[model samples]
Target: MKSKLNLGLLLVAFVCVLACGPKKENNETETADTTAVSNEPKEFGEADGKKVSLYTLKNSHGVEAHITNYGGIITSLMVPDKTGKLEDVVLGYDNLADYQKDSPYFGALIGRYGNRIAKGKFTLDGEEYTLAVNNGVNTLHGGKKGFDKVVWDAEKITTDEGEGLKLNYVSPDMEEGYPGELKVEVTYVLTDDNSLKIDYTATTDKKTIVNLTNHSYFNLTGGVKGDILGHEVMINADKFVPIDSTLIPEGQLESVDGTPFDFREPTAIGARIGEDNQQLTYGGGYDHCWVLNADGEGMTKAASVYEPKSGRLMEIFTTEPGLQFYSGNFLDGSLTGKGGVAYKYRWGIALETEHYPDSPNQPDFPSVELNPGETYHTSTTYKFSTK
Candidate 1:
C-alpha cells in the first residue's frame, strides 16, 4: 500500500509541472511580441498605373507612423499623451483615393520649390523657366504635378537608431518646367526616443533649383478633437519674411518685434490672429516664413508647440534657414479626413522648414541652386513629449 501511494504522488507532481511550464512560456512570448519594433508594408493602391504601398513603422515604445510611397506622404502618426495613451496627431485621410483627390498637401513631401515663385517664372543662368501656376498668380509647391503627387520607390531599412523608410524619386529634366534630372532620396526614421527624423539628400545631373520640405498638418489635440487655435507656439525667429497680397515674399525681411509675427516667446496661436494687420489680412492668417535666429546653425530648434488639453509638446529641429508657420486658414469644412472628421478653419498647423519662398526670384535670399557634383542635404526632426 505504501509503494502504490508513492507512485501516485510522483504522477501528480509531474502533471502539475507540465501544466505550469507552457503557461509561463506563453506569457514570455506575448511580452516579447508587444515590445518588438516592426516595419510593415501594405498595398495602398496605385498611382499613374504604378503600384503604391503604405509602410507602417513602429518603434519599441509603441509609437507608430504610416507613410505612403505615393508622394511619400505621412498618412498617420500615432503619439503618446500624458496619460500614456496613443492617438493620431497628424491630419490626413483614410484611403489613397481621398489623398489623390483633393488633398491640400496634407502630410506630403513638398519639393523643387516649397512655397511660391513670383508670376510662375524665374530666370536661371540666363535662361527663362516657367512653372505651372496653381496658387493665384504664383507657382506654388513645385507646380501642378509636384513631388507630392508622384509615386516614389520605397524600401524598409534598419539602422542603429531605429527602423526607417527610404523613398526615392527621379525627376526628369523639365518634368514640371524644372531644369535638372534630380535624384532625390528621403528617409524617415521613427526613433525609440519618440522622434520622427527626416533626412533628405538630392543630386542633379544639371544645374537646377531645389527646395524641399514636408507639409504635415498637426493638431495635437489627438485627431482634431478641436481647432489648434488654443495651442501655445514658440518660434525661434527674430525676423520674418512678409508676403504681398499674392502671398509671395516681398524680397525683404522685416523684424518681428511688436508685430503679430513675433513668436519669440510662447503665446497662444489665436492671441493676435484677428488683429487688424496687413500681413495677417494678406495671408488670411499666419502663412508666412520666419527667419530662424542665429544660434550656431545645423539642427537648431526651430519651433515648439504645446497643447494644454492633452499635455502634448512637439519640438521641431532642422538644419534649414527658414520655418513657415501656416495656421491652416484654408482648411474649410469641405473635406472630410480620417475617422470621417470634417477639417474646419484653423483645424491644423504646418511648420515647414526650408529656404525662403521664391529664392530664385529674391536674389538676396539664400540660394536654392544645386550645381552638378554638389549634393543637397538637409535634416528635420519632430520630437514629442508630455509636459
Candidate 2:
C-alpha cells in the first residue's frame, strides 16, 4: 500500500483561512508569515538558546555538501559526472525544520553502537545492562535518542589532505546503559581526489564498547526519483553474518560463496533481493552485514557501486571489517522529501561501514571494546567518479 502526506492540501486550507481575516492597518508585528517556504533555515527556537551553524563543503571540481550542526546531518551532497551535471546523491529533507521532528535516520552519524542489541540487554564482566529499546523488541542504533538525534559540536579543520569537518560528542558514563564517559571525535575530509574520508576516534574513562557509522541513504541517480534496484553492486566480501527476525546476528559466520550474499562479482542489487530467502523476508529486503574482505585495520577496499544511467561510481574504503548494505525497503511514501517529492521503496541505499552488528554480544565477532588509556581510531573513505 502506498501513502502520501497531504501537506500541500493543508497549506492551501491554511491560506484560505488567513484570507478571511479582517484587513487591519499596518502593524509591525504582522508582516509576512516569516515562516513562508524558503530554502533558508526556519528556526523553531533554540535547543540551549544558542544558534547552530550549518557548514558547506565545495571542491575545485564544483562538488559540494551541505552539513548542519544538528545531528551532524548531511543536508545535501552535490556531485558531477563526466557530463558536468551536478546532482545531490543523498536523500534528505529540504530544511532543518523537518529534520528536527521526524526523520528516518537519513544522513546522520550513528553510534555508541551502530546496529542492534538483543532485547536491549547485554552482559559485560558478569554484569547485565539494559538499554533503551526503540526498535520493536530490540535496541537499535544506540537508542531512541542515539547519536543521530543529538546536536554534535562541529569544527572546520584544514589538513594537507584537503578541507575537513569534525564532529565531537561525549557520551556520559552509564548513558544508554553503556559504561564509561566516552569521548568521540568524527572527522570528515573531502580530498582533492574526490574521496570523502571519515576518521573516527574515541576514548573512555572506563571500559566501554563502541561502533560508529554514518546512516546516509544514497541514490547515485541524484535521489530525485526511481529505485536503486538496477544499480550494479560489488562488495569485497567472502563471508556474511546471518541474522534472526530481530535483525541481530546469530553468532555464525556463513560463507557467501553459494548464496545471494555473494557480491564478489558485480550483480544488480534487486537480482536476488526478492527471492524467497528467510533473511530477506525478515528484513523485508537486504539489510545484512557482510564481513568485508579487509585486514580489519588500515585502509582497504570494502565495496563498490555503479549506476550506469549517471555513470557515477562509488567505492567504499574502510578500516573496519564489516559493511551493512541496506536496501530502502522500509521507506513508505508517506513523508514528503526535498522539492515536495514522496520517497518510495528502494529509493535509496545505505552502505554503512562499521563493525559487525552486536559485536559486543558475540565473543567471536570483532572486539569493539575501548578501554581506559587507549584510543579507538578508525577511518573510511568514499571515493566517487564516473564509470
Q: Write the per-residue lDDT of candidate 2 for residues 1-387, one digit (tens) a residue.
A: 122347777778888777655444234235544423332433433444556667766667877777777777787888876587989898989877788777888998888989888888888788888989999898898988888877778787778887778889998998888889999998888887787888899999998888999898888887566899988999999999999988999999999987888999889998999888898888898999999887645788999999889988999999888999999989988877888878888899999998988887899998988889999998889899996
TM per candidate comes to 0.91, 0.87
Candidate 1 per-residue lDDT over residues 245-339, each given as its tens digit: 99988889999999999989999999999999999999999999999985675788999999999999999999999999999999999999999
lDDT of 1: 0.94
Error of 2 at 171 (Å): 1.4
Task: Report the alpha-carbon TM-score of model 1 versus the true structure.
Answer: 0.91
Shift in Å, residue 271, candidate 1:
0.4
The lDDT for every candidate, in the order shown, is 0.94, 0.84
| Index of the highest-lDDT prediction | 1
Pairs of colliding residues, candidate 1: none
